[model samples]
Target: MSELTAFLSSNVVFGVWGGLVGLSLLVLAVDLHQKNAHLSPMMKFVWALTVLYSGPIGLGIYFYAGRKEIAHDSIWRRGFRSVAHCYSGCGMGEVLGVILTVGLLSLGNLWVALASFSLAYVFGFGLTMGPLMQEGETFSDAFNDALYSETPSITVMEVVAIGADLLLAGSAHMGQTLFWGALIFSLSLGLFAAYPVNVLLIKWGVKEGMMNPKHTPGNAAPQTA
Candidate 1:
């Protein structure tokens, strides 16, 4: 009986860490698909969950379902190149951000680390796609841009959320409290950090004359007089 209890406890701890690692990877992957890309949000979500829960099986699913196909024809080469470049840049940014944040949190406390990560994700989703819309850069684009450009901000906010979670986790030592508190802190800080960066990106897009406000059917641009 004691052995069984110890095993269960160990599993719970492992599960918590696994969940955080999985979630961070999932968020990074989703952020790679730009808003206007030929992928659906639902599809991204499924991929994220798969990566989180299933490990190797999830990676196989990603290669099959999440990987984008590029056309090699000369006419489409430039566009494809642009898309590839954008995604690559986004991927690098997300990787760095997630690594730094997770590393710092891991050093402090495991629960706090996981909570910070969860909050980062929740807040990232809300800030990147919620109210502001910010010129429809997709959740992926916004997140990548934020991660890439605002590394310091992300690191700081994540640390703050982790610290807060640690305090709450220590006090209550209750699963529900830790989870909810982490979620709330992550969401709040994520929004606070992401919103301004999104706005800046929007402003930059507008200045660069790349702001596309409408998505015409069939993904075609309407002719103007």
Candidate 2:
């Protein structure tokens, strides 16, 4: 037990990675609850194994391939027609923002990076909360709405949060004098790497009209004759 504790304490990278994997699994659980109400026992077992072991890559694959097959038409295909239509006007902004933020950080301009990160964080968070705002509910209602309905937007926010955490970690990993520089560089790379994938998911959701404001959870109720 002592050895195990020591190993985990010393290995921050592994711990962070494991946390990310765990989060992916948690999201998978939420997806299962939302979309797999009629899945067989065997399929549930397979899903458990896939989510626990395969991590984020597994989540991506299942979302693109397996989940679509069993997913309800109301949940999966209720919105738009194609990926292209969804991704319109989503290009270059994220890429350029990341580049400029990182460049400033590399030049020891931590303030600039912090400002940019803050703005991006606010924008993403607000977008994630937009639906709830429209309803004029209490804080709890808005929070719950954001949690349950905004999966893609929530995922994007998580990516940014993870990038921020990584930036802090990179600072500590490097010396104090160079910490900001290293953090900026690391965050830049992370943003660039993740932005394209996010754009793709956005497109997928948009093409599917998954982001449409009219498609709320209440709208997904089964009809009775």
Number of backbone collisions per candidate = 2, 2
Put down candidate 1 lDDT per residue, 1-225, tens digits, no spaces.
334333333546556656765766765465444432444443345345434433444455344324443222221232222222222222233333334444443333564456445554455444334422566776677666555544433454455544544444333323443443333333234324433443453345421211121321233354799
Model 2 residue-pair collision total: 2
RMSD each, Å: 13.8, 14.4
Q: lDDT for model 1, please.
A: 0.40
Residue pairs with colliding backbones in model 1 are 31-140, 119-186
**TM-score attained by model 1:** 0.31
| Best-fitting candidate, scored by TM-score | 1
Q: Counting only residues 3 or more apart in sequence or on different chains, how many pairs clash (N, Cα, C under 3 Å) in candidate 1?
A: 2
TM-score of 2: 0.28
Evaluated against the true structure, the overall lDDT of model 2 is 0.41
Residue 114 lDDT, candidate 2, scale 0-100:
52
- State every prediction's TM-score relative to the real structure: 0.31, 0.28
